[model samples]
Target: MTKVQKGKLISGLSVGKKLTVMVLVMLIPFSLITVFLLYTLNRFGNSYNLVVSNVAIANQYNLEFREEYDSVLYQMVARSITKDMINEELGLTNPDDMTENVRQSFDKLVTSSTSQNARKSAESVLKLLTTLDNRCNDINNNIIKGGAYDVNMSALDNDIRVITELIQERISEYIYYEAGSMELIRSAMEAERIKLIRAIGMFFIFFFIFVLFLVIYLSSAITHEVDILVGEVKSEQINSRNLELKLLQSQINPHFLYNTLDNIVWLSEGGRKDDVTGIVTSLSRFFRTTLSGGLDYITIKQEISHIESYLQIQRFRYRDILNYEIDIPEEFLGYRIIKMTLQPVVENALYHGIKNKRGGGTIKISMHHQGGDLEIDVEDNGIGMNSEDTANLQRLADGLEKAREDNAGFGMANVGERMRLNYGPEYGLKIESEYGKGTIVKILFPKENSN
Candidate 1:
C-alpha cells in the first residue's frame, strides 16, 4: 500500500489498540536493556563487596598479630622495663598473668572469621602466637632462677628478636596477598562501570526518539477523529432544533376547538343564525392563525389576534361569566415570538384559574420591553392555585418534573420548553399565585425573534 493509505489504516485502528501498540513498542526493548544492565551492575556490586570483606578480615588478622607481638616483647624484656609493671627485671616474675593477654589475641581471629580463606589465615596466625608466648614464658622462668644482675640480658634480647621477625614476616605476607586481590577486583569493577555509563547514554537517546514519535502520532490521531465527531454533533443540534419546533406546533389547542364546535352546534339547534355565523367566523380565524402554514414564529400582532379569536369563542360559551382584555404597546406588536407560547398560558388562566371561581373573572394579557428582554405577564383575577400547586406548576414549567403521559399537565409545560429551546435557559416562565386571590404568570423572552 501507498504511505498515505498505510497511515490511514493505522489511524483507523481503535484507540485502545493504538495505545496497546504504542506501549509494546516503547516497553519491550527498554525493559530488556534495563534487565541486562541491572544484572551486570549487580554482578559488579557483588565483586566489589567481596573485595571489601576480604580486606576487613586481613586487617583484623594483622591487628591481632601486632598486639600479640608487642605483648611478647614486653614479656621477653620484662627485667629491662619497670619492675613493678613487668616484675622480671628484679628477679620477681608472674608467668601465668603474662600469658593471659597473649591468649586473648589468638582467640579473637578464630571467632570473627566468616570465610574459609579468612579462617585458614587466622589458624596460621594463632600457631605463631602460641610459639611466641611459650618463648617469653621460658625467658621469665630463667630470670626467676638467676639473680637479676647475673642474668644474660644480650642473649635474652637476641632470642625475642628472632621470634618477632617470624611473626612480622607472616603478617606482611597475607596483607600483601589481600592488597593484590583488591587491586585486581577494583580494575574489573572500573571497566564494567564505564560500559554501564555508555549503555545508559544509548538508552536515553533511544527513549527520547520514541517519546517524540509517540507525542506526534497520538495527538494527530486524536485530533483527526475529534474533528469528525464535532461536525456530527453540530449537525445533530440543528436537526434537534427543527424537531423541537415541529413538536411545539403539533400541540394544538384541542380543548378550544372541540368546545367551540359544540358551541356552534348548540347555536344551530336553537335556530340562532346570526350567532352561528359569528362563532363560525371566529373559529375560522382562530384555526387560520393557529396553523400559519406550519411556521414556528409569527408577529406579536398575529399572536394577539389569535388569542382574541379564542376569547371570542369562549365568550359565546360562558357569556357573562368569562371576560378578557389585552394591553400591548403598538411598538412591541411588530416583534415576533415562538408560535403557541402565549395561548397555553392564557388557556391555563381561563380553565384552571377563572372557571373555578365563585363568579365571572377577567384575564389580562400585558406586554412591555425591559432591558434586553420582552416581559409578558398573563394575570387572572380568578380563584388562584394553592402554594403546592404554584410550586408544582413552576417545576413543570422549568422541566424539573415530568408531565403526565396523557398530556394532562402539558399545556403550560409545552409553552415553557418552547421558550427555553428558542431563547435559552435564562428565558422561561415565573408563576405567582395565592390560593383564593389570583395568578400572575410572567414569561420572559429575548427581544430578538427566533427566526
Candidate 2:
C-alpha cells in the first residue's frame, strides 16, 4: 500500500552481451576446425614421411645387396681375388659382415614398419641371409680342412650359389611387396585427406548457417522488445494528453464557469463582499489545480484541494442542499495520483445523483487501504439506483456496454477510462448502490510514493 514501480518489463540479453555470445558461438566451430585441420595435416605428413623413408632405405639395398655379396664370393671361389685383396677392395666382404648390414636394414624395417605384410617379407629376407651365412661357414670349413678344389667348387655351385640366389630373390621380393604397400598407403592417405577436407567444408557450412540463424533470431527479438517499450510509452503519453484535454474542456463549460461568474456578480450586487471573495478564491483554486502546470500527476493533497474547491463553488450555487465531508488520512495525502481524477466523479455525483433526488444530500469522501491498493470512495445519500442500474453503471465503466442517452454516467465513465488507461484495467471505478439507501463510488489505484 506504499509505493509502486511501474513500467513495461521485458527480458532478454543486452546488445553487447548478445554480440559477445555470438562471437563465442562462432569461434567454437572455427576453433574445432582449426585444431582438426592441424592434427590431420600433421598425421598425414608423418605417415607419408614414414612410408617414403621406408621405401628409400629398401631401394638403397635392393641392387647393392646382391652385387656386393655375390661378386666377392665368386671372386674368392675362383681364386681371382685373395682375402687381402677382397678386404682391400671391399671394406665389408665377409659373409657375416655382409649379412649384418642387411640385418641392420631389416632392424629398421621391423622397428618402423606398420604393414604386417612388409614386416613378414623383411623377416623372410633376414632368414635367407642367415642361410647364406651358414653356407659360407661350410665352404670355409671345407677349405680349411684341405678339401679338394673340385669339392669346393661343387659346394659353391650347389650350396653357396643357390643360397645366395635365393637370398637375392627374397630381398627382391621384399622390395616388390614393400613398393606395392607404399602405393596402397599413399592412396589411403590421399583418400583420407580428401575425406577430412570435405568434412571440414561441411562443418564450416553448418557453422555459417548457425551463426546466421542466431543473428536473425536475436535481431528480431531485440526489435520486438523495442517495439513493446515504444508502444507502452506512446500509450501512456496519449492517456495523459487525453486526461489533460478533458480537464481543459470542463473548464470552458458554460454551465460551470459562466454560472460561477454570474454568482460572483450577484454576490457583488447584494453587497456580500465576503461571499464574492470566497467564490472568486475557490474558482481560482479550481482552475489552477485543473491546469496543474500541464503535469500528468498530482499529490493526493492537491487532488483533495481541487475537489474541495469544486465543491465550494457548487455549495455557493446550491447552498441549501449541497454539503461535503473529506475523511482521508494525512499519511496518504503525499502519495501521487493522476490529476483531476476525483473532480469529475464528484461533479457527476452533483449533476446526476444529488440533483435527481428530492433534496440534495451530503457527499462524503473517504480513503483507505485495501490490500496493496488505495481506495477512494465518494459516497452520496441521494436517490440511489437499484442493483440493476448499479450493474449497468459498472458495465459502462468497464467499457463492456454502450453509452446511455441520458448521459447520466458519462463523466464517471470518462474518469474510469482515464484511470484504467493510466494505471491498468484492474485499478478503476467500482460502483455499489442500493435502491433505498445510498451509492458509493470507489476509485482504486495502485499505491505509489510521490518522491
Candidate 3:
C-alpha cells in the first residue's frame, strides 16, 4: 500500500523523505529472516529432543535384564541364595513387581516414541517380557517343590536364558533404532535448513535490489521536482527584476532636477549667463537619454552618451572639484546594454569618491574587451575606502545584499542587479579600492552582437 512499494510516481515527495521509505521497506526481509530462523530452529529442536527422549526412556533396563535374570536363576538352583537373598543381593523385587516395573518402562518408551515402527518394536518387547516372567516364576516353583536339580538347571539354561537373551536383543534393537533415527532427523533438518537459508537469502537479495531501485527512483523524482521548482522561482525573479529596473528607469530623480535648477538660479543671479545656458543644454540631454523612448535596452553608444550628459551637468555644478572622461572605443559602442547601466557607477564615483576628497579629483571611464566579455572600468582618484568598507560595498554591487534607495551606493547596486538579472550571474560589477588612494569599478558584460 506504500507509495514506494507500489513504485508509484509522486512528484511532491521531497528528497529527504526518500530514505525513510527505503529503510522501512528493506527491514521487511531482515524481519522475515529472523522469524524463519527461529521457526526452523524450534521445529527441528522438538524433533531432536523427542528422539533423545525416546532413547533415554527405552534405556532404563537396557543390558541389565539378561544378566540379572540368568544370575537369579543360577543362584536359586545352586542354593547359593534364597529368594530373600536374591532380593538383597541383586536388588530384585518380587517377580511380578519386577516384571511390572520393566513393562511400565517399555510402555513409556512406546508412548514417547515418535515413529510407529519404534512404538511397535517396544510393544513386541513388552509381550516378550511377559513370557519370560512367567517362565521364571515356574522355575521358582520347581525349586520350591524340591525337584531334581537337572529339571531346574535344564530349565534355567533352556527357557530363562533364551528368553532373557532374546529380550536383551529386542531391547538393544529398540535402543539402537531410537539412537540411529537421530541421524535421519539431523540430516533432514540440515537439508531443510540449507534450503530455507537459500530461499531467504535470495528473497533478501532481491528485496534489497528492489529497495535500491526504489530509492534511486524517488531521488530522481525529487530532484526533478526540485529542479522544476527552482526554475519557476528563477523565472518569477527575472520578471520581478525586470519590473524593478523599469521603475527605476521610468524617470529621472526629482531631487537632481531640483538641485540643478537651484544651481541654475544661482548662476543666473551671479550674471553667469553662458554657464547657465551650457548647464541647461546638458540637463536637457541628460533627461532626453534618461527617457530613451521608454526602451529598457539601448546600444552602448546611447548608454555612454547618457552617462556623459549626466556627468557633464555634475562637472559644471562641482566646477573646481570634479573632472570626468569617457575613453570607450567607437567600434565597441555598437553593442547593446541595459539603459542607465553606467550612470549609477558614474554617479557613485562623483558623490562617494570625488565629493569626499580634500582637493579636486578625476573620474576616468574606459572599456576593455577581455575574451568573451566586455569590461568597462571606471577609475576614480578620490578619498577611497578601507578594505572592510570596500568588502561590504562589494556585496551590494554583486547583489548579495539588497540595495535600499537611501543607501550610499544604491544606484550602483541597482545597476549590478540589472546586469546580472538581464544577462547572467557572470555579468556584474567588481569594485577594487585602496584606502587614501583611489577606487576602480569594473562592469562585466557578455560581448553580444549590437542591437
Which of 2 and 3 is the better model by lDDT? 3
Error of 1 at 35 (Å): 76
Taking the tens digit of each residue's C-alpha lDDT, what string does model 3 give over 179-205? 556556656665765675466546546
lDDT of 2 at 84: 40
Error of 1 at 407 (Å): 5.8
- Cα-based RMSD of the predictions, in order? 45.2, 50.2, 48.0
Best model per lDDT: 3
lDDT of 2 by residue, 1-451 (tens): 3233211111256767766766797767656755765675467456656755675676567657666776677666666344445677656476667788889988889777757766876776777677677767766666666666665565565456545554554455454445455445445555755665565556556555656565446445534654453354344334322322111322234678989999999999999999999999999998898888755579999999999999999999998888899999999988998787898778877776787787778899999998887989999987788989999888877756534324666666666755764566788899988765678999999985233
Off by over 4 Å in 1: 1-250, 253-255, 405-408
In model 2, the clashing pairs are: none
Model 1 per-residue lDDT tens digits across residues 1-451: 9999989988999988887777778667656755765676567456545544544444454455444545544554554443234554535344344334434643554564334444554565556556655756655556656636324243243334444444444444434443344444445555665574565556556666555465445435534553453344344333322321111243565766788889889999999999999999888888888888645579889989888888888899888778998999898888888777787888888888888898979999999876878988899999998999899989988867645424445677767765664567788999999988999999898876532
Residue 402 of model 2: what lDDT? 37
TM-score of each: 0.45, 0.44, 0.45
Worst 10 residues of 1 by lDDT: 239-248
